[model samples]
Target chain A: MSTRWYPIYQRGNPQLRVFLPNFWMKLVRPTEEQPPNVVTFAVSTEMTKHDVKNYLEKIYKVPVVEVRTRIALGDTKRDQTYGYITKNDDVKIAYVTMPKTEAFKFPDLFEKKAEQLEKDEKSMDDSKEGFRKFLERNKKRPGTPGWFSI
Target chain B: MSSTLMKCLSLANTLRTATLRSLLTSQQKPTLAPWGAVVPALASHVQAVSGIHTSAASLGLMEFFDDPKVWSENEVKVGRAWKPDELRIKSNKELHQLWYILLKERNMLLTMEHECNDKMEVFPNPERIDKVKISMENLETVVRERNKAYHLLETGETGERPQRLVHNCFGLRYMYKSCEHVLPPFMNIKWIKSRNVGFGGRAVRKFLLQYREKLYNEKRKAKNRSRNEVMMILRRNPDFDLEVLRRQFPQVNIDKLRNEDKARGHYVPKIGV
Candidate 1:
């Protein structure tokens, strides 16, 4: 059956099952410090706690001991000069609890970023030095093209 | 002491070989390993599998994060979306599995984007999210088409929700999608009351008259704009092809417009040349 139109559930009717559920849930880094077993998630606004539980259990196979959800209001800002107001979409945040034995810590994604940036800076400096040396070499011959010597 | 050293060396060699063998076996049968471990090996099996995949154990919350290799990179290149034609040949089971895959990819992208924003870093290759979205849309469309075909063959009707053109209380006509109701039309008092609204008052008639006039004015202005454009083109290029101009602006009567005074160029016409 097409998920666009789900059959209404009446008493004594068979349970409704979603074959291709469009609901999306993203595991997000918690804004605050929490227990290791408690994970944060930003789920679709339409999804309930039960939906989040089932999604994790069935699809990702993540065992969930408990689920608590809250809809966080999106930020609203007024244009500084235009006097117009704009609002961001509100997100439903689901806090899932795993077994006490299951502990997860959000990994630092950009730990190597600083090192990479330093390496990039080093290369950039090398290029700049090379260009400076080329300019110095060509100082005597003002009209000489770069390809004339290199 | 020499015999003991030799025995220790031999025992360490056996341990190393045993670990190597286990690792090779795990890598060879990726389907038997955990979901996270199977990702690298799944590339070859993706084309061969036509049914649902019972992936090994989950990656826990770590599945939300991207691979560590790309975390520091400035760009991540990926292939394009799945086209409808490509999805059409696949069975429903494969499409369902693909949907979950796309969904996870989208979630991963979104999570990374959010995290990047939080860290004030650039989310590399943002177009990857759009690609995943396009694929999901195409997959849904293919599934809908199959559903429609099946319904038509078996039930003699498309299994789509019923909708009808309805005039609202504001006198604006719109397509109102009908939903399933527990009570019939006569039994549902609230629905009957909501749907019973009719537009008739003098105020509404005046509003509709003004609205129609506005629509007519827009149409008239568009026609005049096209006519003026054609006149300008003819004025600038007097020897312009009439057939091409006629095809370009079919609404503007090019034949009648050709002899108009406005269409005449500033230069004097070559008479009887």
Candidate 2:
């Protein structure tokens, strides 16, 4: 059966199961600090606390103690130029509590960003230096082709 | 460590071994064609490089994020989506596994996109989502095709949702996809009542009449236009191929129009007895 076509669950009928679930869950950093055991997730709107628990336990094999969920209202702001209001989509957030021993601190993703920028700057400087050296070399022979001499 | 932790460690070890074994087996196999060597080379490179893989972990929190290398990169390159023909060759089990992989990739991309948007940063290579979507769609289509073939073999009719041409309240015809219901159509009073729509009334008749007249006018005008074009062509070029004219303007009678004075060109035709 297609994913969209769901059969009505009667009292005696065999339980319906989803084979290929297309639901997506993203682990996002929480705005407010919480216990290390508690991890936040932005989940599909259709997902429930049970679904979140099953998803992590079965798919990712992460041990979950409890699951708390809330629907966060999307931000709304007025347009600066035009007097119109713009709103973002509502997101369902799931707070999954792992075992007491299991501690998960949101790792700083962009910690090495400064290092990468420095490396990029170094490469840019090298290129600029090489170009300047080429200009210096061609000063004597003004019209000489770049590939003409060593 | 807990028993679950031990199980996870073992699972991770087994997974690593399985991946390595596959890589080795693939590389050892002889290439059928000269171009076939590229797959093994690329596969091995992708499999071996752990540093380049940003979030490769065993049931860890890193599973939700993208590769660190791609996070700062301006562009992320990806191959095209899986074609139906390519997917058709894959076994059901393989397709199922591939589907999950694609699903995870799509989720990762979406999460990254959201984070980027939230940070007011440009999302790199947004087309990656579209690629994954197309792959998932193609995968579903392949599965559906297989299901249809099997259903046709077992059952006489296709195991698909039944639909029929139905008219709406506006008197416009459309295909209505029918679904399974707990009660039969006759027993469902609410459904029956809903189905009974504005199929009558003087307004509908008048609207249909005007609509039909408008349609008829358009058709009539097109016929006249083609007829006039044929007449004009015959009048200008008398020696024009009647066969070609007949093929083009089949609605216009060439023989009848040929005898008309209007069809004759300004230059007199040379008559040989």
Output the number of the TM-score-best candidate.
Answer: 1
Q: lDDT for model 2, please.
A: 0.73
- Candidates in order have lDDT scores of 0.78, 0.73
The stretch of ten residues in a row with the least summed lDDT in candidate 1 chain B is: B45-54
Cα error, residue A83 of model 1, in Å, equals 1.7
Candidate 2 structure quality by residue, lDDT tens digits, B1-273: 355445544544443344322532353321111112222223333131112222223636666777766576555544456678777876776677667667667777777887777776677778868877887888888888887888899997667777899999878799988877788999999889888877688888889889899999999999989888888999988889999999998889999999887888888678993
lDDT of 2 by residue, A19-44 (tens): 67788888887889999899999999
Q: What are the DockQ scores of the candidates, in order?
A: 0.58, 0.37
In terms of lDDT, the best-performing candidate is: 1
- Error in Å for residue A78 of model 1: 1.3
RMSD of each: 9.8, 9.3
Q: Name model 2 segments beyond 4 Å from true.
A: A1-4, A76-87, A128-149, B1-57, B201-273
DockQ score, prediction 2? 0.37
